[model samples]
Target: MDSFDSGGVRIAYIDVPAVGGSGDPVLLIHGFASNHAVNWVNTLWVRTLSQAGYRTVALDNRGHGESEKLYDPEAYGSEDMAGDAVGLLDHLGIGRADVMGYSMGGRIAAHIALDHPTRVRSALIGGLGMHLVEGRGLPAGIAEALEAPAGTPAPNPTAAAFRTFAEQTRSDLRALAACMRGSRQTLSRAEIAQIVVPVLVSVGTLDTVAGDGPGLAALMPNARALDLAGRDHSTAVGAKQHRDGVLAFLAARP
Candidate 1:
């Protein structure tokens, strides 16, 4: 884990170099309530991308991992999050790079491509969609369940992991909810259409959070969709099929 000061906020990230040699840098952004290690590292994403001849850079988005978490709801806006990526690239002297983002990170990537086109060469968005501007369709009981404290000790690590991830996120749940709400109002198909970079829109077949994969793909002018058969949002991130599809897309890029 390396650290860099991006516009006064301390940012944490891991830079994984390609196997053969340095290649096009690919910045990775993880989802909500998860850190870079949890979302990407544990999923073999860095290894997969590096092996495919791409230098992978995964960052702990503010408020999620080792990065500083601002309590102010206003700080969690997509523009602010997108600026962090742009700031990181500027700090590192990277002019432009391909970017891949999942879930909330995917939303940030869209904003980055829309707002900072000169700094983005291409984009791969997963676990999310342009249609999800209003936020993922959360279940009715989810909000209540998330707010309530754990009643008993978890039996297994997987259960414990879920609790821990959830607890850590509760620190700024209101901010998170607000950010999701604001994202929908801030992002639009017209804005997305302005992005000229090549894009790959990927979603799990059972991903309820992102809505229809093809519907989201239709919003982008230069985009294509990749469906991970038989996989849900959580499982798709680590699935071999997902990695293979991403690699194929990256390889075909100019």
Candidate 2:
């Protein structure tokens, strides 16, 4: 992975060209507590896109993966992380590209599509849905779980899942805790409605954490939803259904 300075934070990223030749760029943002490799590479998303002739670029948000970690909660806002993503595109001289993000990264991608509309050709939001507008994101206790002592039990299943994932990824728990504390900003209904670019909102039908997929797509003018039947948040990211849906969406994007 390569590194770049984004608003004074060091962000790590990998830029992979399409197998045949240069192609339309696709910027990928991974979910919280997960990095480029775990969320995209290990999931075969990079390969999937590359084989389909789309250049894939993925980045580690400031506090995750090989990026510089920050402990200040204020530094982890979704908009701030969105800026890092835009900066990566600017660094690579890409003025616009297809952007995709999962879960928390979906929130950041939403910010990019909304706040920097000119830089986003299309947006693919995965593992997220109406929660991007209605809810605050994740849940309470996740930050606490990240900060708890190693043997301490989390207060709930969701928190425990996050804690276990952070541990599995060997994340900087304090940095992720601060990220959790600061990055839960949600978009309003009116704001979501203003995203005019082609958009695909996909979520697992069985997911409890992402709100309603069809409900969210209904709020956007040019967005549609894909239900990953029988999948949940944990299983949705790499599911074959998800990949197929995304490929179809990209193929049909204007």
Q: Which candidate gets the maximum lDDT versus the true structure? A: 2
lDDT by residue for model 2 over 1-254, one digit each (tens)?
89999989999999999999999999999999999999999999999999999999999999999999999999999999999999999999999999999999999999999999999999999999989988744668999999999989999889999999999999999999999988878999999999999999989988999999999999999999999999999899999989998999899888
Q: How many clashes does each candidate structure show, in the order listed?
A: 1, 0
lDDT of 1 by residue, 1-254 (tens): 88788677788888888999988999999887778887898899998888888888989887667787555556677888888888888877788999899988888898898888888888889988644554444333333333345665555443444446657645354434344333333466677678778888889898766777767777778888999999887788888988898888888876
The local distance difference test score of each candidate is: 0.76, 0.94
Candidate 2 lDDT trough over 10 residues, lowest sum: 130-139
TM-score of each: 0.86, 0.98
**Residue 113 in candidate 2 has what lDDT?**
98
